[model samples]
Target chain A: MTNVLNKAINEKPVTTGMLLALMAATAYGSSQFLAKQIVTEIAPPSVVATVGLFSGFVVLMGLSIGNLPKDRKAPKKAVVFLILSGIASSAGVTFLYTALELAPVVIVAPVSSVTPLISLSLAHIFLPKMESITAKTWVGAILVVAGVSLITIGSHI
Target chain B: MTQAIIFALLAALGWGTSAIFVRLGLQNLTATPGTAISLAVGTILIGIVAVTAHGPTAFNLNPNEFAWIVLLGVLNYVLGRYLNFNSVNLAGISRSAPLLASAPLVAVAMGILIGGETINSFILLGTLSIFGGVILVATGGGRG
Candidate 1:
């Protein structure tokens, strides 16, 4: 564990992937507030999701054109995972944007915050080797759930 | 409050799992294809549902509405999705998820500054608690 820590620390300041993730998280986190604003003007959650997905698809496709992996075509197995994941992603966004449409950003944001707990729990159940559920994790998970609940309570005001 | 909270919780669970699924799916394809394909699939599904429920013109909208939708979609979905997938790949979900969740605070600030929204006592307390709890969970990781 110490060695792993040292290796991670000693690595180059930041990798492109890590930078992208941080950017993505911040961008996503901010979207709650933005979506809340836009949904006020636009009524249907499906419309919001559809438009957003199409725009994102076009943008990503455009960006990816010159960067295609110089390797074999995407595996069929990967396509299946991508489809399943697409559903999950779409479902998440649908709920998120819909929630934003209905409530304040502050009220809606915390609910999505508990995502880690869910992912971790699901990972524990489905991918045991990848993640360990320790007592601390359970406690943290509980706190996230409870904290989100309180945020909901606050939203009623 | 309860209903809104429930909705948010539902959203969070979905978002959290979405992160996991993105990581899982990215393993199978190039980042670009993976992102585009995923969004395309989702958009199609959503389009079908909207059309079925509302009719063929479900997607019909004014240019102004379309602009906002497109911009938000690009910012949050395209840009955000790419960054997030990369972050998970780099930092791992443990660090990435918590930081990502901190976005509520950002929204709170934006709400105050732009939305002319005021935070009441309960909201103040709740927001503080949420941040405090997040700090605990994040720092508990023992690295940062």
Candidate 2:
């Protein structure tokens, strides 16, 4: 059992990564539906965001406590970036919950999923070495924007 | 409707930029600590907002609501985020990103099945186009 576990962990990173990504997407995607239900029943979007994030923080803190001593000495820059990232993500969650309150899950999910296009643009500008924007990427981005436009327009009609 | 779409786009922008920051920070920290710190920070920020907007009562959810919130936190923040960070570490953001973007597909299906969300051909077409575009961007074949 240990050898099997080790082999799975060590053998194929790309495959494992893809699988993990898929699983994450599924969990996150389904979350919108659940979130919609929660918001309808209880608190507002801000409260939901706060409670959910705090619960998550508690869980992650518990899980990470063992590594905290060694990891606490991270560079100041990384800490700053992570804090900023957290702020940004908090805003995202707030907006997402607001959107969910206003619209159906199907409509809100696809529209918000366009994060990749924005991420790609940011990567091109900030971290060129990390990701280079190609013609295909441009086309893809255009298609995504166009699709989002269509959905928005169509939903109104 | 327009308001909802705008808010959703804002969310996209926030999440998109957050990914870059996470990647940058991950350079110095591993997934576990990085996730813990970021989530803790985000929670505090959101908690502040919640307090200011709705007062301390904002945290006063019903027992069922609290349970649901806990479940959501576990599912999305703990499991979902852990997988996402690990995927980025392993596959690089460029490759793992589009796959992550595919979350909408799952959401749409689940929404219809569980949430009773109705879908039209327009929505179908839009989803297909978005998925196609995300794939193109992910496999852009650019210099790494």
lDDT against the true structure, per candidate, is 0.70, 0.86
Index of the highest-lDDT prediction: 2
What DockQ does candidate 2 have relative to the true complex? Answer: 0.68
Clashing pairs in 1: A20-B83, A21-B83, A21-B87, A112-B12
Q: Can you write out model 2's per-residue Cα lDDT over B1-144, one digit (the tens) per residue?
A: 889999999999998899899989989987777877888888888888888988997787678779999898889899998889788877777778878878889988988998888988887888888888888876783766
True contacts kept of each: 0.58, 0.79
The positional error of residue B25 in candidate 2, measured at the CA in angstroms, is 1.7
lDDT of 1 by residue, A101-154 (tens): 777776666556666667666776676776666666656766666666666566
**Candidate no. 1 TM-score:** 0.81
TM-score of chain A of 1: 0.78
lDDT of 1 at A59: 85
Docking class of 1: acceptable
What's the true lDDT of residue B64 in model 1? 88
lDDT of 2 at A53: 88
